[model samples]
Target: MSQTAGVKPMAIAGRAVSERERCLGMTDAERAWRKQWLKDQVLASNEPVHVEELWRERTNPIRRFYRAPLDKIFSGLSGVLGAERAATYRYITGKLGLLALGILGIHYYFKYNGNDWTKKGGWRVLKSKPLVLPGQEGFPYKSDRKQPSDYAERGFKKAAI
Candidate 1:
């Protein structure tokens, strides 16, 4: 008896068939039909399957670095101190401190070693008596002149008397 004949003929009609025959004993035509049926079943299942090649290619080494034990420990330490406070302290104690010190050093160096401001032409120009333009008031040199007071009629005591 033939292998297909001895086995009861599978009902290809609508029936909940749980068991499946292995493709090894199936003829070329039977195998092709089975493949198409399996493909249709998978498409109808509405489940997602990851493509192995794409998944392998997309995995990142940097993600591993972030997940490393030492990195996690350091991140926890910074979190405990508060991220903003830790960052500010790091800046002040690191390059920012050096930059501030360098600026102060430059200012002091110029202050002590540089030419005096009074000796410069700009300072001399500023210090000299301002030139009075036409129709402009000149500096009053009279020390004995008393200023007119609005409070004089208001019963305020006059210091001059």
Candidate 2:
């Protein structure tokens, strides 16, 4: 004759229904009500709560798969190397992993493309030279002759004197 709160105990052929069966038998309205009730409880507690924490089934499967192995590795490292050294190893390994990935990407990119960028004029094939002829205006140099500017003449003339 005992019953739990929020659950309506149903007798099927004079036997009590299991928790999973009771949950499965709930309608859409019941599910929605339960969700709202949980939300209300969270609000009343005034504590930070995630949607995943609210529902056990809402965990990311991919994250879960990677987490176990990573946790094991981290714990093993911590035990062997101590916490500080373990953190350093994690940081170094992460950077090395990223570098390796970058190197592999660059290797594949160059292998597939092979001088196609130069062919497409993305880069110069030869060293560039000044387009102007010697006699033309806007030429590069006047024979590298250092002509004294007005400021240099004024400053240096007095200094030399």
Candidate 3:
């Protein structure tokens, strides 16, 4: 007794259609529900599917410059803050650090920022005083002078194991 002799072959005239197999498996009511679902909101949400120009116009280098360096810095900070695990100690410390920074910024904005300093027109560029060379008193005002000795130490020290 062969398998085809007992049951319908689940194939059309000569070629086997996969859609025919799926239709045969479901009742008419289920087929209508499945068709309605496939035509519903999720499919409609992605209409006119491919928009290459939309992405092309919005690819901004300036915005990426502002975000890129700091994105990695904070991305690592989330791991340092133990955000991956549930711990009361980590949450408390993280929030305390955030609170401290917020308070410090508020203090600076109130104390050094307002009224008497640089009147309502907003923060003016802080005019810097000319720097005088320590040993060269009469050597003229040159900005290209070499830096002092200790700051010029380029020596690399090997780790003491």
Candidate 4:
């Protein structure tokens, strides 16, 4: 039996489609071309694919600049630590570096966005007041003038008199 015999023709919009067109939701001709392309790439080159390089090429120049030159760093490590250990360390360090970058990015995002240090009255911009101990003063502590807000008020009042 022919190759087309095994593939059942499918109908779309009331028209019969060829087996190749029905397969994998693509025209059989395109699928064959894609299969051929993969064979060419795999057979032609022994070099492994660097998908991240392609991604970097598509990224903004500023973002590319911020990216650590890990390849150079890892290459040096490979020379000193050997290939296998370097690969392991690279994987570990890469994950940790990304995590740190993410945390710092989030921290700066909050710090600058809608929470400027000077614009929002510095560090004490929050609505909540700090907790005061039963005997400790509230704030505005001075050597000469003492105006305590809590239980410490009685002591200050006596000292003032």
Candidate 5:
């Protein structure tokens, strides 16, 4: 009477027909018959099909299993070098290490040698005058920002000479 009820019967019938079709399609005799039909269609001659010969002629076994010699060489080298050496080599070759080393060397040289522009002596030179900067008042080095008065007392001007 209702549309929903009318649709239920059609749905049930459709499911039953699909199930019947699936069962019919799955029978061993049906499979055998289909195989025989396919074999008949594919193989015209009565002689046995040489699947291996066909595969060999059509597909390359060497290409399927082929590997580049360099890949093997690198893998072997990795095994020989061990993890530490490989990681070290990778790090040393990277830009970060070089940049870091350059920064560190510059910092060390500047810290010890002192910048030429500032006229502030190196650590050894600072021992006598103790080069004090503008902002640094109590601190010894002219570079110290805390001692602002010492820089003024030392007549330290910010202008580049």
Candidate 6:
């Protein structure tokens, strides 16, 4: 004799025992849930379509009832970022990229041409009027990089004539 002849299979109330319940061995609560789900699917499919214009018109009160709220919500949530804001951010980022590229070009130019450090020597000073003072002595203007004290330390001195 087989195991089915020895023991009995579980049934869902008055309904036939499902093959799923026999295979996976579901409890009474699970079988009740499965029966309710099947009944819900059958009732949902049996819903009647009641269009008043026979077959010529498809728009009905049931569709518009659900669409109005969805349309309002969609219109309110769409375009969170408008075209103007998107273009503004794009333009700012593009200018930043060009600025960075220009800086890199300057860096490479200085790196290649940095070694030509010879100063083209001549009387390159700007010929201008001397600084007027209380006496005949004139105060010479010096650039920030050059100091007369440095030249004096090198044994070069200017005598007042």
C-alpha local distance difference test of each model: 0.55, 0.58, 0.56, 0.61, 0.56, 0.54
How far is 118's C-alpha from truth in model 4 (Å)? 14
Tens digits of lDDT, candidate 6, 1-161: 77578788764443334575456676788667767866755645435664647733656778667555544544454466464564565556556867999999888765554432143332222335456656555545444436657432321243333
1-161, model 1: which lDDT tens digit per residue? 67697888777722223334452266677667767777676564435655958855866878555435544554566777886566565545556657998999987776555443334322111133456666667644333326676322322343345
Residue 84 Cα positional deviation in candidate 5, in Å, after optimal superposition: 15
> On residues 28-95, what C-alpha lDDT tens digit does candidate 2 reach at each position?
77667666655655544535544755554756778567555555687688988997788787767767
The per-prediction tally of clashing pairs is: 0, 0, 0, 1, 13, 0
Compute each candidate's TM-score over C-alphas.
Answer: 0.22, 0.32, 0.23, 0.32, 0.21, 0.25
**Model 2 alpha-carbon miss at residue 142, Å:** 22
Candidate 5 lDDT by residue in tens digits, 60-90:
7674344234335444666778755755655
Clashing pairs in 6: none
Clashes of 1: 0
Stretches of candidate 6 off by over 4 Å are 1-80, 115-138, 141-161
Off by over 4 Å in 3: 1-60, 74-105, 113-161
Span of ten consecutive residues with least summed lDDT in model 5: 9-18
List the candidate 1 regions with Cα displacement exceeding 4 Å.
Answer: 1-79, 83-85, 92-96, 116-161
Clashing pairs in 1: none
Q: Give residue 147's error in model 6 in angstroms.
A: 15
Evaluate residue 71 in candidate 4 and report its C-alpha lDDT on the 0 to 100 scale. Answer: 59
Candidate 1 has what TM-score? 0.22
Candidate 4 lDDT, tens digit per residue, 35-123? 66556656435356559878878789886575457757887889899977988887798889999999998787656554332354333
Clashing pairs in 4: 20-28
Question: Candidate 2 vs candidate 6: which has greater lDDT?
Answer: 2
